[model samples]
Target: MPKKVDHDERRRHIAEAVLRVAGRDGLDGATLRDVAVEAGISLGSVQHYFRNKDEMLRYVVGYLGEQVTARIVAGMRDHAAPGPVRSFLLSMAAEMLPLDDRRRAERRAGQAFTARAVDVPELGEALRYGDRWLHGRVAELIGRGGRDGELRPELDAEREAVVLLAMIEGLATDILLGMRDPGEATETVRYHLDRLTPQGS
Candidate 1:
């Protein structure tokens, strides 16, 4: 009898391998052959899962977005009250940083796809829509914070949402470049978060 293969598990393994190769070796090195080797599967098996490079790339893009969303939702669920608006904001923002190996690899893969998406319209659409969803979540959090008196009353939720997202992306970019420490960036973001709230309010 032959060993039964878990197709979904194999696909996930290939996706993870894609991340690793893209992270350590750059996107150009993450060829189908390389991913197949990294995933410990035959080239035919990989082809069986992904019809072509474009399909595989699309899947990887979705995988990274799903990973980030799942992390943010988990963090929100774990917090008893989601704490202050600043706390929720910080927690959600930290999901983008390369604070752990898994996140680091994801960040790398995300950056690679972002650059490639310039010429790939579908990938560009996915990124744009994903970013919009993220911004909506952040804006909602900001609105809640203002109502609870945990944030500055004069702060514009939509504008602050964009700013927060930019800051988080900048921090992640620096981390990916190895020019900034994740810990330091996290602290810096916290400082900015603090400034958004009044001492007594």
Candidate 2:
């Protein structure tokens, strides 16, 4: 009997290989041949999963977005208590920054895909979808924090959510640009979180 192939798993593997090739070479360099090489498979195998380069790029783009969303959902699972909410949020934000080589490579690949999406506006919609979902979650968290007395009484949850998202994205960009180290950038957010917490917290 022949071994059963997991087509979905194989597709995911190809998508990840695309990111690896994109990281090592620029996004444009992640050709089917390069991806096959990175994936340790034949070009025919990758082609079986992705019809062409555009389809591969789109797959990788959605894959990265799904990965980030999964992380966020996992991080939010256990951090429900008011006292731990802010710290938990910080940790979640940290996941977005590149603190290690693997994550840095992934981050670079994601940025490249996102940037390329500008020319293809439909591709950019995936990113915007993620942003909108994340922004809503953050705003809800901020509102919860206020009711719990973790945040200032007067802070506007929607406005602060936007600001926090901007800061987190900016800090992540700085890390990509080598303008800030991950540790310091993380601590900087911690400092701000401390200020946001009530005097006793």
Candidate 3:
């Protein structure tokens, strides 16, 4: 009998290759043939999973979002007990930043996709879905903090969540462009979180 192939695993492997190629080169450089080379597979194999480059690009964007979500979930698991809302918010922000090689690669690929989305409505819709999901999640967290009295009573959770997301994205861009240090960006996130919560709480 022939060995059973894990098609999902193969797709994930190809997506990872796309990320590496896009990070090292640019989005334009991550063509089907180039991704096949990077993935150590035949062009036919990549085409077997994705009909074309656009399809593969869309899959990779979803893959990257999943990776980031997994990171945040893993971070939450590290905390033995329920922590402060600010701590959770900070953790989420940290996961989004390019503080290490893996995250840096992710950031690079993400930036490339963001630019490409400007010309591709399908890609733009996919990217927008991820953004909306994140915004809603952050707003939910902020609302919980407000209810718990951890955050200022006068704050609007939804609006603040938008601001926080914008700040994190701006910081990530700066870090990616070498305009900001990782440590400093992290401190900036923490400082912002501190300002949201009451001193004693």
Candidate 4:
């Protein structure tokens, strides 16, 4: 009998290698040779997972988006009963920042790829679609909160959601650049949301 391949685990390891290469060497530094060496896999294996550099880059960005969205969804579920939605939102949003050493590495990798993707039209378009999808998902969640009286009725969910998302992304970048701490960034968002809450809601 042949050894059973753990395909999912293998894919995750490859994905992580992609992020690691980006973090350590910058986006352009993550060539096939580098990723294969870092991942401890054959170059052919790396190619098996990703057809090209652009494909790998796109994968990393999409994975990051999924991770951040999942964290937000979990936070919202955890804090659903709370009187105000701000805390939940902050908790969810904080997942995007370099709150710890591990997340810092991920943030670095993501920023590197984001910068490069701008010059690659196809990669940029894929990133744009994923970003738009995430924005819509978050906005819908906020709108749900408002309808349930957990958020201020006067708040504009679409615009507010975009602003909050942008703030989180910006703060994450700032944190990576040593301009601020993750906690301070979260506090800033909390302060903004507090002022937006309805009088009794």
lDDT of each: 0.86, 0.83, 0.89, 0.78
Q: Quick one: best lDDT, which candidate? A: 3
Please list the Cα RMSD from the true structure of every candidate, rounded to 1 decimal place.
Answer: 1.6, 1.6, 1.8, 2.3
Tens digits of per-residue lDDT for model 3 on 100-134? 98888899999999999999888899889989988
Clash counts per candidate, in order, are: 0, 0, 0, 0
Indicate whether candidate 2 or candidate 3 has the larger lDDT.
3
lDDT of 4: 0.78
- Each candidate structure's TM-score, on Cα atoms with residue i matched to residue i, is 0.93, 0.93, 0.94, 0.86
Can you list the residue pairs that collide in candidate 2? Answer: none
Clashing pairs in 1: none
Model 1, 83-182: lDDT tens per residue? 5778877888788888888888888888889999999898999899899898898888887787778898788999999998899889998887788898
Q: By lDDT, is 2 or 4 better?
A: 2
Candidate with better TM-score, 3 vs 4: 3
List, residue by residue over 44-106, the lDDT tens digit for candidate 4: 988888899888777777776666667767776776563455666767667777888667778
Task: Write one digit per residue (lDDT tens) for candidate 2, span 37-107.
Answer: 99999999999888988888888888888887788888888765556678777977888778877677778
Worst 10 residues of 3 by lDDT: 75-84
At residue 22, candidate 2 shows an lDDT of: 82
Model 3, 148: alpha-carbon shift in Å? 0.6
